[model samples]
Target: MNLNFDFTEKRVIITAFFCMAFTIANLITVKVINIGFLGMETPAGVLIYPLVYILTNVIADVYGEKIAQRTIILGLCVDILFVFMTTLILFLPSPAYYTGDSSLAFVFTQTPRILVASYISYLIGNFVNARITAKVNEGKEYSSTKNLGILAFSELIDNFVFIGLAFVGVFAVTDILIMIVSHWILSLIWSAIAQPFTKMTVKWAEKGKPAEA
Candidate 1:
């Protein structure tokens, strides 16, 4: 059997690894930070969430939809594993000398509702982003603007589902709506700002591609 250690394939694998890490981290610490001003509040994860979309777009653009979907699934599996491991640890007794169990639990213990919401929202958002990028750029040169537009819309749906499902009964309706809108807008803006970097990464991945010859 022949093996190919192609640079582009390695790039895709590395990007997918980061995507999985980011996805798990985003889910766990999403509720950790609360930024509020003028009567509006949102999770701190919004700052890094856009990167997942950007990476997904790059994968789809450089590789294909099949690879992008595989990455998403791998991420989802890792996220689930993270949740299980954390939950298991929370159930075990902490060391007698360790006084940070409370703090650890505060950060690691996720409610079932939030867990479900996160998984559903993440799968939907990532798959949609991949699909849109694949379809938009199919047999055509990649366009950052088009990718950003599709990502923005996908983020909107992602925010709506996650926020609505996670906080519907916990927060007031108005606050929930505000969070959805704010998160969606922030994610879109972040993606737009990161467009240059995204493009650069895609270009880097596509470099030295045998198929382009």
Candidate 2:
């Protein structure tokens, strides 16, 4: 059976594709990625996750928080789909190339605790970032430096929630605190650097929105 999907006026599909790509790449990099910045070691994961946030922000800027919230829900749905599919595949018989289920376990066996944390934190933090950006724009603070405050605060929460979920107890408490701080700070830096580009992206989107009507 063939399903005729609507591509025109399909912002949800577009946003979901980008978010899925970001999530896949972010998952890969989270295992081992660190760099020293501002006398702190930061995870390279920030490079990818903030893009997701920026996309959400741009969605909110051009469309509205309602659409941005929809995108966040889309992300959560995709994550759940991944979890379910992986679990189903892991149970199936393996081919000869695979010695055992190690690879399956590696991919699908994230602790339930971590999975729950990741799901909750990601949905909350992402919506937080997008909502703040949307609110500021709606309030006509787009031209003010207060817009930067939106970025700073939201990115901090984004990084905090993500890193804390990804490695709250996996590392020592002290190391986890430092890592959380580093991830948060690095995300803030990326948000600032990317906000200008986001304005451009949002402007481009706005131009197209009226055309779609």
Query: Judged by TM-score, which candidate is best?
Result: 1
Across 1-213, the per-residue lDDT of candidate 2 in tens digits comes to 654334334465459665785567436543555474455765455667777777777677667788788778877777777778877888899779888688657756666776676677777777786777777787352442555576667766755676677777688878877877777777777777877876766555554455443
Clashing pairs in 2: none
Q: Please give, for residues 105-211, the per-residue lDDT of candidate 1 as tens digits.
A: 88887778987887789889889988989899987877878988989988998899999999998999998998899888878889999888888877777777676
Residue pairs with backbone overlap in model 1: none
Q: How far is candidate 2 from the true structure (C-alpha RMSD, Å)?
A: 4.7
lDDT of 2 at 127: 78
Query: TM-score of every model?
Result: 0.88, 0.78
Query: What's the CA error at residue 34 for candidate 1, in Å?
Result: 5.0
- Evaluate all candidate structures by whole-model CA lDDT and list the values in order: 0.79, 0.68
Specify the highest-lDDT model's number: 1
